[model samples]
Target: MNPLLDERKATVEADHQWIANLEVDERARTGIPLLKVGFNETFGYYISISRAKADQVPANYIRKQTLKNEERYITPELKEREARILTARDDLHKLEYEVFVTLREEVGEQAEAIRHLSRAVAAADVLCGLAELAVYQGYCRPEMVNGRELKIVDGRHPVVEQSLPAGFFVPNSTELGNIEETSPLPDLIILTGPNASGKSCYLRQVGLIQLMAQIGSFVPAKSARLGVCDRIFTRVGAVDDLATGQSTFMVEMNETANILNHATSRSLVLLDEIGRGTATFDGLSIAWAVAEYLAMEIRSRTIFATHYHELNELAGMLPNVANYQVTVKELPDQIIFLHQVQPGGADKSYGIEAGRLAGLPTVVIQRAKQVMGQIEKHSKIAMGLREGL
Candidate 1:
């Protein structure tokens, strides 16, 4: 008989009755509380006890099984009845499998409808999750604009801030173009700060905020005004594609070329440490020209984060270029990263101090400071020669 038939109700009720009657309690002859009582193929039914109280078992309790920690036993009554029921169930299993296949195909006929409904339910769950995250993180709804100008108030890097301890991650503000500026092309900000400061975080935050808003989600910011963007281009960290035989510098140039070729005025570009894979002068010159290209030609709202303070000179040279730096406080012995972005370029790169914090040798740090002093003195002397000419 098919298990799905109404006549099989009697059989299911019989199984329930058999299971209910087979119930055992912790008050067994072992005098130790039974931790678990369950059944499986190898162990039909078992009662477990702690090894500490194994000595308390009565002499009549014939040990059917022995583990390192505990013992198992079975009364003759349980084994006899269980064997009769198992023989019948084994025969029923083969017949039941064929019936199950037919029932499954009947259900499979409706799979397309079920799949569509599952998709709808999944989409609802995702929206609910995003809503909960927005509420929990105190994210604000970003305002969308038709033009290319981004403004974020007290924005934070979502992933970085979450990884830090509560209240440890500092927030920063950004603006690509002022609401009152009324310019067609949004100005680009040149972000210069010491190594290990929050310049990269700031650049990433802007891109993420814009992306989140475009997707109809709240952003990680106190408030944000997002400009229309066809695409958000990023040339941030680099990695050599050794399998493809491309060097790190080649990869960097390829990404930079991609941005230069495709980006438009409405694009938001985030560039970090660009042209840094080559020598000093070559890297500086490329970084300088790339910043100029974005500001002068592409006019995309951009954040160009770099150690090359030389690029900061574009702030005065180009109308759409402005300078910003991550604020850090210098102590007698150590520098504290405030993680605050403010207007103007950093006076120095603080590379030696950054190296000191990176666990470099003290002698190397001192030697670097001396070398920096000498470079500055020679720079002034060279300037004197140019003035004399």
Candidate 2:
């Protein structure tokens, strides 16, 4: 049996249970009897209106308001019949009240039981979720026969695909070499590309794929060979913690530190735009050090996406590091994302073009272009001076 597919099936079944419990709770709150109540004796009594009437009757009926002045007294035969009927009715009412009370109590107990069951189902779902995510990770497990490498082919991001507008998804593939079984594993992949070129999306795809595999679902990839990972870590966006009195950079660093400390060799780590919350030099230095630590120290499979061009040099220096850039086609006054990953680092980031794409005015676009050119020239001169020094 395919363990990954089995895991996904288990997850769907568990989720169905949770869905059932929700429906049960909603019905219980509204006093709608569950079909399962058919098995109970109280439900049998409630099903028949004749039984309900026999069970309870209002006492001391006047019978007629116009006959109040008349000498309306109970006849001996009528009184005798009334006594017998009232006595039976009172007993039945007591029984019916008991049934109602018991039903209420049972509802509470059933709700609690459903709650406990739902929690168990949710826990199982988490495990299944993990297995499903493994389907996208390209890490191959050793084959049962001769330890052959398995491959993960053309994996798409399931969530991203669903969220994107129709006809916009771009497919990408990841694979491991089978013949060269001893080839070095791809541990650290550095993604460099222009802004809005799908760098973050690609990083997220990797993370999501692993997560889905762990949960035991079919991944968006056409095919996948996944090694079960211990944990998946992501340090993507930065937000200021005003209450904690920490800057955005500080918050980012804190998260990074947590991931670094907790992530194991079997973990999958995704770092996006790391160090961007601080100054260029400081951020670049931190990003470089973090990359080195992940590559040399942890040796975990990682995807690091950033705009720092200097850091891309690590692809040449580090053994397991590889540089991948998102492809973009530049037009006369516009840019389009090819949504494809290619070899080598990106030389330029078209921030102005991105701004224009976001509907910036013509004057602003022209000014941004001029400023960008000046910055590029200054950056080059500064690098040249540093090299000379």
Candidate 3:
């Protein structure tokens, strides 16, 4: 990067040429083809002549060291040349270091200006990308308001839609909080459906749309009018924190407590399978209480996605609660995932069908069916207990 660096490098290389030529010249003078110039840290430079030809060396060659098979010698001229080489190399290195320090200081002086420019360039890059996405993906600009409302018509997940073929990704609508003329939409939606029915995708879509709208970017939707949210809280998957010695259920409870402690009416909360990490009854009770609190107390624009069909009862008890499900088509032998979110709750999760599709053993599937029938027959007691809660 600096011209001085190149100049010093060339000078050092040029100085090394003399040492090589000395080796050739000494070999010719001493009539010993084995005469050579070598350098080491202990002895800077020397000419090595084999012991048999040591007597033939020129008288000007003062002995520096002797070995069993060779004698190391240094002439006055060689010493002078070695000193010059060492001094030139030292000066060159010092000059190169000075050049680097100067360049670094200059960059440090412009650090603030460079950082400001970088931020501006980064922001421009993001806006350019969003603009290109809007043009190609047919995204719409959402209307942003200051109320507790979020409505999206025919919205698709921005990332998921890209993975799917064109016209294949089913678009779903979301309505929350109040719209002017229509009946007041629910503040909290209890999303129930079969496993892998795209419930998580749908929840993410709504959150992404709301975030895109607030950030002045077009949303992946046909139309949207989103209220500005103070925050977006999400608890989507299960993971154990082994480093902290916390089980999956404990980690889930910690995150849930944090959300409940900080979430407000102006926030958007997306929860998935809130209590599946614990026992059935314990999990059900916690899920029910969490849904009820989010709906009645915090009044956050929330989507509670769960396999707990019993949660549907919250819609009848809480005025700001509603039920939604991702529908499926059930055949005699198997089920088809429709991946369509619509009103009303689903009673069955069709998890056994999912296992069957996943290639579970036939005997295992059959035994699971029998076990499920027995569990359902006794589930009335659990249902009654849930109603009491």
Q: What is the lDDT of candidate 3?
A: 0.91
lDDT of each: 0.79, 0.66, 0.91
Pairs clashing within candidate 1 = none
In terms of lDDT, model 2 sits at 0.66
Best by lDDT: 3
Across residues 271-323, which tens digit of lDDT does each residue of candidate 1 receive?
A: 99998999977897788889888888888888999988767777766778888
TM-scores of all candidate predictions against the true structure: 0.74, 0.63, 0.83
lDDT of 2 by residue, 1-389 (tens): 34444554455455445434643653454343431111122211011112223223123312221222221112233344444544545555565566678778988879978899999999888767645554544223222222222245666776778688855788776532123436765578788888888888887877776666555455667666766667888998779899989999899999999989988667778999889998888888788889889888887778899888776778767777888889899888678889898777887777777888789999999998898888877776335434542
The superposed Cα distance between candidate 2 and the true structure at residue 302, in angstroms, equals 0.6
Name the candidate that leads on TM-score. 3
How does model 1 fare in lDDT?
0.79
The order by descending TM-score is 3, 1, 2
C-alpha lDDT of residue 327 in model 1? 88
Pairwise TM-score winner, candidates 1 and 2: 1
RMSD of 1: 7.7
